[model samples]
Target: MRTLVVVRHSKAEQSGTPDFERHLAERGHGDAADAGRWLATQGIGPDAALVSSSVRTVETWTDIAEAAGWDLEADFDRGLYSAGPETALDLVRLTPPETTTLVVVGHNPTMASLAQMLDDGEGDPEVAGRMNEDGFPTSAVAVFAFDGEWADLDMGTATLVAFHVGRG
Candidate 1:
């Protein structure tokens, strides 16, 4: 089975920061670290990650990697900077079938929407319900499980296995 983890970029300074250069806040840092630990405990160490090229997204992935004790090299894509759910989905499809696990660290509402769109509502009902109701908050993690290769992945073909909101 293949697994996908979608993570929204953490909170960032709202003012005086450019859209592309915004850095995470102190709370964001702590929340990201906690999320990383959560991923480790959940046994979701991704083999590879596709991250946005924005400062905040890269920082978030770095913190997650450090906290999880993972040695992953992220593919920072400029197309993911302000991409939509469809764009993100296309990227997922491009992943090599040999990659059993993948993670995408990006911004919302694209990341959040992609998580919801990919979920077939066939895994944990509670997690799916929470995701539908609360939406994908910053630093949130959405875990999906798929039975086929990445090339065969499509909308509503994967199951939502877990959802986690980073807490500072």
Candidate 2:
């Protein structure tokens, strides 16, 4: 009955600078904030937040936290900066079972792929409906429910609850 929310970091600005250091554009800040607000409407206050250490990811989470007003404390991990979906899954699996809800704010194609990869509800209409909604845009949040404890979550074991692609 626990929830896992995966938030693909907000749209970021491209610069001549290296990828890890790029900052969020002005529009991205607002987009990230919009996502946070939307998540609030959906009742998404994560008990724990696992975030990437990249600058853009950090900035996006900051704006999201401000908008959500959850004042949540997050654990920033450098491994998440360039980690793949499997790596991310490992982090989630290791989360303390006491955490009822969790959020992972990071990058994608891994995010999108992970959603599809971990979807468990094959014939359920709502799961398919949510999957059909839209791409995981900047600040997009995907919510899913796992059949087992977080410690035992596996590929294709999650059922999509809601897919939010926020617009600013």
Candidate 3:
């Protein structure tokens, strides 16, 4: 079975400037590390990661990537920094089928919506609860299981296997 790990970027600093260059805050660092450790325990480590180019998202992935010891080279995609759920889905499809697992570090609404959009099947009750309980916080990770190829993955086609979301 192939797995998809949809991770929302960790919390970022809110600067006075109106630009999209805000970096992660101190709390964001801790949260991401905790979240990464949590992913390893859940066996959600990815062979590769498709991360956003956003300063916050990039920084978020750095901590989690290190904590998980994934030892993978990440693809920083500008499209993902501000893409919608559909866009994210398309990106996942681009992954090679040989890749057993993948991690996508991106923004909210898209990540959360993607999880909610996927079809359910024998999912962990607690996992689903966490995905919705906190609105997909920064550094949150949503685990999904699929029996087929990524190209065939669709909303409601997979189950919400597990969710390692943030507390804040």
84 in model 1: Cα distance from truth in Å? Answer: 0.8
Candidate with the larger TM-score of 1 and 3? 1
> What lDDT score belongs to each candidate, Candidate 1 first?
0.91, 0.84, 0.83
Candidate 3 stretches greater than 4 Å from native: none
- What C-alpha lDDT does candidate 3 achieve relative to the native structure? 0.83
TM-score of 3: 0.93
Candidate 2 lDDT for residue 27: 85
Candidate 1, residues 1-168: lDDT per residue as tens digits? 999999999988787868999999999999999899999999987888999999999999999999999998999999998789998999988998778899999999899889978999789788988888889999999999999988778899999998999886
Q: Model 3 over residues 1-168: C-alpha lDDT tens digits? A: 988888888777788854358888898988998888888888776887999888888888888978877787899998997789988999998999898898888887888888788847468777677677867877778888888998988878888887776543
Between prediction 1 and prediction 3, which has the larger lDDT? 1
lDDT of each residue in 1-168, candidate 2, tens digit only: 788988888878888988999899888898888888988898888899999989999998999889988888899999988889999999989899889889899998778777777888654676466555666667878888876788789898988887777567
**Candidate achieving the largest lDDT:** 1
Q: Candidate 2: deviation at residue 63, Å?
A: 0.9
